[model samples]
Target: MRQVIVLGAGLAGSFLACRLLRQGCHVTLIDDRAPMSASRVAAGLYNVITGRFGSKTWKAETLLAELDAVLKDPFFQGVSQFIHPIHIYRPFKDVEEYNQWSGWSAEPAYHQLVKFEERPLFPEVIHNPLGGIRILPCGWVNIGGLIDRLQDIFRSNGGVVLQGSIPYDQINMGQKTLTWKGEPLGFDQMICCEGYRIRQNPWFEKLPVQPNKGEILEIESEGLDQLPFVITKKVYMVPGESGRWIVGSTYEHLFDDPGPTEAGRAQIEEQLRLVLKVPYKVVGHRAGIRPTTPNRRPILGSHPQWPFLYTLSGFGTKGMLAAPYCSRLMTAHILEGAEVPEELRITQFKAFRPT
Candidate 1:
C-alpha cells in the first residue's frame, strides 16, 4: 500500500486524510496535544455574493453543489440539513448611497443577486433606515462537528493519529521515512496542513505565510430564535444550529497568541450591540491565527525541492467554502496525477517558491 503521513489534524488535514483513506491509501495524522483547532471556533458560513465590495467568486454555485454531495455522506457526524439560504442585509450608510446602489442594475454583478421587497431575515437586526439587499444561497456549516466527524472517519479507515508534534529534522526525504517519537515510519508522501504553524516549517518556510490573529465570540439570544440567516456589518453574527450564534471577528496583524483578547472581545461586542435590539449573553470566546498569502489565494503544490511533500492551506476565512472544492482538486492532482486548477495552483503566487 502507498503510505502517506499527514501533519496537522485540522479541517484541511482531517479532510485530506479521509479522502486519501477513501482512495485506499495508508495514512497517518499527527498534531499537537490540543485537538481543538481554528476550524473549531469558526462559524463556517459560505456565501455567494461577497456584498457591496468584492467581486463574485469563481464557480461558487458549482462548488456549493459539490460541498453538499461530500458533506451529506452518512459518515459525516455533524452533518445536518441546517444548510439554508441566508438573506444578507446590507445596512445602507445613507439614502444617497442606497439610491446609487439601487441604480446599479445596469452592472452585471448587481443584477445577479438582489430582488425587490425582501424582508430582513431577523426583524430585530437594526440597520440604517434605507433597508438592505438580499444575497442568495449563503449558509453556515457545523464546523466543529464536521471536523470531529472527519477525524472519526479517518481513524475508522486504519489511519494512525499521534497526539504530539512531529519534528522537521526527523523527516528523511532520501529514505522516504519519518521518525516519530524515535520510531521509524515509512511513507510514500507527506502533506502538511499545519495552518499557521507552516511558518515554522523548514521545508516550506520560504513560502510567504501571512498569519493573522483573529477572535470570535459565541453568544445566545432569546430574541434571535427567529433569525434563520446570517447578519454582517463590521463584524458578522452567524446563526448556528438551535438558538446559538457566533459574533466575530477582530483582526490583529501583530499578535500570534490564540487566546482571546479583551480588545477583540470588546470590538465584537460593541458591533453586535449596535445591531441587536434584544438582550444576548456571551457564551464563549476564542482566537486563532489564519494562514493567508499575500495574493489572497490558497497555497497548493509539491515543494520545488521535495516532490513527495505537498501543502494544502491558506484558505483564510473562506475555508468552509473554499476547502471542499479545493481539497477535491488537490486530491485528484496528487493521487490521479491530474492537473490542478490554475487559480488554485501554488505557483500563481510568485513568492511561493520552495527551498
Candidate 2:
C-alpha cells in the first residue's frame, strides 16, 4: 500500500485523504485547527451558474455530476450529514439583465439547467420585481461537519490518523524517499492541501497564490421562512433551518487579518439590505481566508524539485464543488499515473524554486 501524508484537514485535504484511503494508502492527515482556512468559513455553495454575466463556471457539468454521484455513494452517504442539495434563484437586476437571462435560458446549453420556461416571479416575501431564474443541482455543504465526519470514518477504517500540523522544515522530500524529524519516513507521497496557508508553504510560495479574506453573517428572519432555495442578488441569502439565512460575503484582497472586520460586516449588511426585503437580526458573523489563484484555477500537482511533495489546494471560492473532482484527479495522477489537467498543474506558473 502506498503510504501518504495529507496536510490540512480542510475541504481539499479531507477529500484527497479519503480518495487516497480508498486507494488502499496508509494515510496520516494533519491539521493545525486554524480558523484561517477557507473551508471553515466557506458558505459551501455549489452553483453551476455564476458571475454577473451568468456565465457557466469552470467544468461545472463534470464537477456537479461527480458531486451528485459521490453524495449518493454509500460511503459518502454515511459521512455526509453536512450536505444538502437545493436549487438556487438568481434575481434579475433590471430589464437588461432580465433580457440577457431570458435569451440565455433558451439556448441548448442552459435550457436543461433551468426549472422554468420563463423567469419566475417570486412572492412579495422577496424583492424580485424583475423576476428570477432557478438553477438546479445547487446545494451547500457544511464543511466543518463534513471534516469531522471524514476524520471519524478515516479513523474507523484504521487506515488514517488525524494529527497536528507538521513543521515545514521537518519534511525532506527526496525523489525516492521522504524523511521527517531526521528519520526516514516510508511514504510514497506527501500531498499539501494547505488552503490559504499555501502561500506560506516554503516549497510553493512562488505559485501565485492570493489569499482573500471573506466574511458572512447568519441572520434570523421569520419573514423568509418559506425560502427553500438560495437567493442571489447583491449577495447570496442561503436558507437555513428554523427561519435563518446565511447572508454574505464581502471579498477583501489585501486584508491584514483573517478575523471578521467591521467594514466587511457593513458591506455584507448593505448587500443583505439590497436582497432581503425582510427585517432580520444578525445571529452570527464569521470570516476566513480563501486560497485564490490569479487565473482562478486549482493549483495542483507535484513540486518540480521534489516529486514526492504534491499540492492539492487553491480551489478558492468553489472549494465545496471543486475539491471532490480535483481530489479524484489528483489521486489518479499519484496512484495510476494519470494526467493532471493543465489548468490545475502547479508547474504552469514559471516562478522561482528554492534550491
Candidate 3:
C-alpha cells in the first residue's frame, strides 16, 4: 500500500485522508486543529445557484451528486446529524430583478435549480417587495461535525492522527521526506491541504492563493426560529437550533488581524438590517481566512519540482460542495495517475511549474 501523509485536517484534508484510506493506502493525517480555521467556522452551505447574479455553480450537478453520494455512503453513515436540507430564498431587489428571475426560472438551465414566486413568502419578516426565487438542492452541512466524524472513522480504520502543525523547514523536498520536530516520519507522498495556511508552504506558496478573511455572527432570535428556509439578500440567514440563527459573512480581501473585528460586525449588521426585520442578539462571532484563487476555482495537482508532493486547496467559499468530488479526483490522480481537470490543475499557473 502507498504510504501517504495528508497535512491539515480541515474539510479537504479529512476528506482526502479518508479517500486515500479507502483506496488501500496507509495514511497519517496531521492538523493544528485551530479553533477559527475556515472549515470550523464555515456555514457549510451548498447552493447550486449562487452569487449576486444567481449564476449556476461550475459543475453543480456533478458536485452535488458526489456530495450526496458521499454523505449517504456507509463510511459516513452517522453524519446525518450534520446534514440539514433546506431551500434558499433570494429576495428580489426590484421589478426588473424579479422579471429577470422569472425569465431565468423558465430557462432550460435554471428550471431544475430554481423557481420564481410572484408573491412574497414572508412580507412581514423580509423586505421582498418583488418576491423572490427559491433555489433547490441548497442547504448547510455542519462541516465541523462532519470533520469530527470523518476523523473518528479514519482512526477506526487504522489511520494515524497527529495533532500539531509541521514546520516548513522540516520538509526536505530533495529527499522527499518530512520530520516533525526532529522526529522523522515514514511516508511515500505528502499532500498539503492546509487551507489559508497554504501561504506559508514553501513548495506551493507561489500558486496565487489569496487569504480572504470572512466573519460571521450567531444570533438568538425567536422571531426567526420559524424560518423554514435560508434567506439571502446582501447576507444570508440560516435558522439553527431553538431560537438561534446563523447570520453574516463579510468578505475582506485586506485585513490587519485574523480575529473578529468591530468593522466586520458592523458590515454584517448593516446588511442584515436590509433584509431581516426581526430583532436578534449576537451570541457568537467568528473569523476565518479562506484560500481563494483569482479565478475562484480550486487548485489541485502534484508539485512541479517534487513529484511526490501535491496540494488540494482554493475551494474558497464552495469547499463544502467541492471537497467530496475533488478529493476523489485527487485520490485517483495519486493512485491511478489520472489527470486533474485543466482548469483546476496547478500547472496552469506558470509559477507552479519547474523553473
- The candidate maximizing TM-score is 3
Instruction: For each of the candidates, give the backbone clash count.
Output: 0, 0, 0
Q: How do the residues 1-355 of candidate 2 rate in per-residue lDDT, one tens digit apiece?
A: 7788888889888888888897789988878888767887878788999988888999989998888777787776565567888899888878887788778888999887875425445455777777778998788877788887877777777655645656776665654444454665667788888887887789877777788888999999778877778988879988764456788888888878779878888999888787776788999899988888888998778888777788988887898889889999999999988998888887777763334
Predictions: Cα RMSD each? 2.8, 2.3, 1.2
Model 1: per-residue Cα lDDT over 1-355, one tens digit each: 9899988877788778888888888999998835335676677878765644635666777777877877577655455543455766555555665566666534776576654323343454565456555566667777777777777777876888888877889989889889988899999999988887787888877777777778888898788777555777677788776667888887676875668878889888888877788888999888877777776677788887678889998877678777777777778888988887777677765655555
The lDDT values for all models are 0.74, 0.80, 0.88
Worst 10 residues of 2 by lDDT: 115-124
Higher-ranked by lDDT: 1 or 3:
3
TM-score of 2: 0.94
TM-score of 3: 0.97
So what's the TM-score on candidate 1? 0.89
Q: Candidate 1 — which residues are off by over 4 angstroms?
A: 33-36, 51-54, 72-78, 81-86, 100-125, 349-355
Q: How far is candidate 3 from the true structure (C-alpha RMSD, Å)?
A: 1.2
Please write out the lDDT profile of model 3 over residues 235-277, one tens digit for every residue: 9988764456888798988888999999999999999999987
Report how far residue 2 has shifted in candidate 2, in Å.
1.7
